[model samples]
Target: MEPFMSDLSALSSALAATAAAAAPSLVSVHSHRSRASGFVWKSDLVVTADEALADEGEVIIAFADGTTRPATIAGRDHTTDVALLRFDGRDVSSTPLARDVPPLGSLAIIVAADQGTPVAALAMVSKSAGPWRSLRGGDIDARIELDTGLRRSSEGSLVLDASGRAVGMAVRGPGRTLVIPAATIERVASKLETHGRIARGYLGAGLQPVKLDEGVGAMVMSLDKNGPAAAAGLRQGDVITALNNAPFSSMRGLMRELGPDSVGAVVDVAALRGGEPMRVALTIGERPA
Candidate 1:
């Protein structure tokens, strides 16, 4: 059913007012669907250097014209798809995420478009290292769940705090959404802008930690050959029993154990090749994209 004009007008008014008041703090970017390629810049966000985003993925902005843009993909970290982009920053206005940044264990609510406009919502801070999720019919993860706000938000809406500081950017979700923290985004932006993409090392394997069945060794899934694991002969289904002789129950533990140096160093991978206990010493490769 068509939304009542009065309701749309009210919402537009509220959003417009908020944006107008905060426009100085936000950058506005304007791009349009080009008959040739994709979207061409109609305009860019204009803001002081202080207000300019650090160059991470596209920032969601309010257009003075009342139109919305989805987003442009830029420097993406394979390990973390946190990217950067320029936006049609003309109407640029947004209430930043709150300041008292959510604690390490605090919750984050990120709203993005499900259909058209954003519906307010929340997402639990799964762990310090994300892929944050917003569960359906379950207690909120980040103490934040969409209260029906994702619909109007584009993929790049900034999730703000009560005071209007940016904390999280809405990226993806079903009931569970993926958001890149602002802090992480800031760190990745400069590099992305300089390189047009993320410039992280490559480790070609996609590995997952799983509880092995009795008699089964460590379990690895989501194999990526170009990753460190594959470079080190770590193949899919290669059950990991030990990393550098450290017994790990989870992949996070394993990754932590390897750390950054693992990118170029060789590590002993103890595993059950096929029910027979064995070991394969492979050199860790670069961080694969």
Candidate 2:
């Protein structure tokens, strides 16, 4: 019991130190519709959860020094749940992204100060894997989930490694805490600030993975009404074997091939319809905003 108490005390001190180090970049985001946490991304750009800034109105950013400034939503990506705000105030120090993230099971800290002084919670990297899609179909470059439960108000807090380098941002899931990797945030934020939105190719089809002779391909379970797939004469149960000569290993792979770069471009699609192989020229459509 004494040993456990000592470990807990040491962890508390470590987390406090981390919070202090990251406090300068942390800010409280307040709006009539919502209140959450955010952090400085660049000179005058702040990043936060997209859901927190979904409300249409002005937002206030309060710093640790008690200075509040007005900010406007510069861009938002509902797919990644990331939103960038252009601040109408002085420049601020931005948090540094860790060159190499901590390995799985390494200690991490979540820092946020929605109202006053910054606070932190000790956690561990529970999952770290390859690129995947969010429940909302956001293309995440990496999978990072924390082991600790975070407060809903800490939705956009900066997640840091033990060395105090920024790793990601906290986001509340159905019943878990997910971290949007720093690399993804940096890439998405840069594009959002420049383009106001990320353009993605839309197939307008609901797909699932199906077993092929030796590999996996996407099977169209359903098609969007009057969408690109429908316009291309694709029907339900058609197994898409390849796109542009690249074998479709999974639905994710197919989606990757149909990225923003593919929007509006006509490509050859290989599929199996009713056990017969066929080809179709599909003009990819722009995903709805």
Candidate 3:
């Protein structure tokens, strides 16, 4: 009994220490639409959930010290659900983004602020997997789900690993808690810092992955009326086998090829129509903001 009690005490102390160490970087993000949380990055940048800023009116960054500053949206990417806001607060202590995710069932600490004081929740890394896309089209390097069942206010909370390094940002999900992995955060943040938005190519078609004899390809589930695919004479039920002669395995694979750089570029689409092979040339379009 004594040994178990001692272990529990030590774990509590460690979590408290980690929360304290991460306090300075955690912030409460208040927008016209809702209030959430975020963390300082670099000196002038703050990262938060993009959905928190979707209303996009006046935004305020509130610290545990009771200080507040106005922030301007530097950039936002809906796909990754990350938004970068510019706030040049003096002597800002930023959290370092961890390069790798901890193993599943490891302790994950979620930190936020209450009246300028750090509050935290200890949870396990419930789920972690390799590169995947969100239903909304974010191409994330990994998926991390926490077992905290955190509140909506936990949105944008900084999720830290055992070493107190930030591993992800918490976001509200349907009946669950999700943390956008650190690698995805860093990648999207850098792009947002430079481009103000993620550059995504648009084929203007709804697609699903279909198994093929050689590999996999995206089957056109539907096409936007008069959109790129339609303009290129593509139709519903077309199994697109490849793009630019490269194998297209899934909808995400097709999306990867349709990056912002591919917009306005003409590409060859290899497809199967009525069990017959054919190819079509079409120009990719820029995704509407």
TM-scores, each model vs. reference: 0.49, 0.75, 0.78
Tell me the lDDT of candidate 3: 0.84
How many Å off is the CA of 212 in candidate 1? 7.2
Model 2 worst lDDT window (10 residues): 250-259
lDDT of 2 by residue, 28-125 (tens): 88877687899998879999998877477778888998998989989888879999988965568888776355689998889987674577788889
The lDDT values for all models are 0.45, 0.84, 0.84
The TM-score leader among the candidates is 3
RMSD of every candidate to native, in Å, equals: 9.9, 5.2, 5.0
Q: List where candidate 3 sits over 4 angstroms from the true fold.
A: 114-117, 204-266, 269-279
Which 10-residue window in model 1 sums to the lowest lDDT?
A: 33-42
Residue-level lDDT for 195 in candidate 1: 69
lDDT of 2: 0.84
